[model samples]
Target: MRILLAYDGSPAAETALGLAISRYGDDELVALYVAEVDPTTYDASAFGGGTDDVPDSDEAEAVLEEARERAVQEGYELETAVEQGSPSDVIAEYADEHGFDQIVMGTHGRQSISEVIVGSTAEQVVRNSPVPVLTVR
Candidate 1:
């Protein structure tokens, strides 16, 4: 079985990655980070200024890099992808196109009010995914 792990370096996402490794270490593992490009905007700051030390672009790349290194250390050959698109759509499409047996992701655990306004990516993926989706809190 192949597992597709959606990683963004959030604590929850890191937990999901760990769960995937622990449960399906013997299977094929693919880690993906969607860059979440906003087609309407070009200002980099739009993606930053959230109290994170690094810029969003740098942080995204850093997280992917760290995940690759961790995978290597864990003795698994990880297929990683950095893509430009909406997170839910990109993740679901990639998993389907690649024939992944399962999809693993982490949720920010947003409450009803925020979810109603912005919608949760995990919720969207779970709803639209072709395969089983495991969401780590």
Candidate 2:
């Protein structure tokens, strides 16, 4: 099966990667890192703050490299990609556009009011994804 693993270098994401590797080692796996671009017009730089929400190219590369290394350690060749957009949208769209059979990702598992107000990426992806999404916490 063709699987797309949404990787963000988080602990949960690492767990998801490990699970995918162990269960679907021989499947076609692609680790996708979505660099969430801030859609707001607010500029943090003007207020003496750095724009840390949006990751740079180097950071994206580093995350992909880490995923690749982990897959290699498991004796599997993994494909990787970096995309810029809302994480949930990019993940779901990429899976559909790339003809993936399923998507595997990690969830923060936050149940607080803030999480309810602003849903987590995994929740959004689960709601909007074209294929089945397996979320590992």
Candidate 3:
């Protein structure tokens, strides 16, 4: 089975990564890190105000590298990908485009007003994903 693992270097993501490695060690695992670009940044750039604070691919790569190392420590090799977009959108689209059989991700378990305003990435992915999603907290 092909599994898309959403990794963001968070503690919850670490837990998910370890779970995926242990439970689906024989499956094809791809660690995906989505570099979320703020839409306002793009809008500002379009209006001639270039922002240096935009999330870069390098940051995404670094997180994916960490995921790879963790997988290695667990005796598994992981393929890594870095994508630019909203985390949930990127994850769901990548899983569909790559024909992944399942998606494994972490839930931040945020229960604050900010969570209500911005919604949880895990919840959004679970609602939008074409394939089954296994979320770890």
Candidate 4:
């Protein structure tokens, strides 16, 4: 299926990942993590606080690694990417640029934040994607 999974390492995103793993065949998956360069997080040397340690890039890498491991364990061919930018934009770009057939992702479950589609990444991706996006809670 050449699918892309947008993971944020959140419990919600993880649940979506679990669903995706169970639904697709091993040969039809590609996992992705977007760095989500948040302007609020911009700093010259912000890499030393545990509470503030979850930089989008690092978080993205961690999630992608987990997704790839899952795919490998399930015998699926896996590809990974880490790009810097908005989550929705990056996911859409990756899917389009890589010729993905579908996108599977998890949302944060924030149901009122319009700026972020209920404050969830999944919502934003679904709203901004050119291709079909399957959102898992």
Q: lDDT values of the candidates? A: 0.79, 0.84, 0.83, 0.69
TM of each candidate vs. truth: 0.78, 0.83, 0.83, 0.71
| Candidate 4 lDDT over residue span 1-137, tens digit each | 68787776677777877777888756467766655456676542465533234455566666678877876787765677666656777888888888888898876632335545334666667777888998876
Best by lDDT: 2
- What tens digits encode model 1's per-residue C-alpha lDDT throughout 18-74? 888888888998888777655566444665633232236566678878887887788
Candidate 4 Cα misplacement greater than 4 A, ranges: 39-59, 109-119
TM-score of 4: 0.71
Over the stretch 1-137, how does candidate 3's per-residue lDDT look in tens digits?
99999988888998999999999988999988876766755553454542233357677777788888888888899998876667888899999999999999999832355546889989999999999999998
Provide the lDDT at 58 for model 4. 64
State, as a TM-score between 0 and 1, how close model 3 is to the true structure: 0.83
Rank by TM-score, highest first.
3, 2, 1, 4
> 98, model 1: CA deviation in Å?
1.5
Tally clashing residue pairs in candidate 3: 0
Instruction: Tell me the number of clashing residue pairs for each predicted model.
Output: 0, 0, 0, 2
Winner on TM-score between 3 and 4 is: 3
Candidate 2 wrongly placed segments (more than 4 Å)? 40-55, 109-116
In candidate 4, how many Å is residue 94 off? 1.7
Candidate 3: where is the Cα deviation over 4 Å? 43-54, 109-116
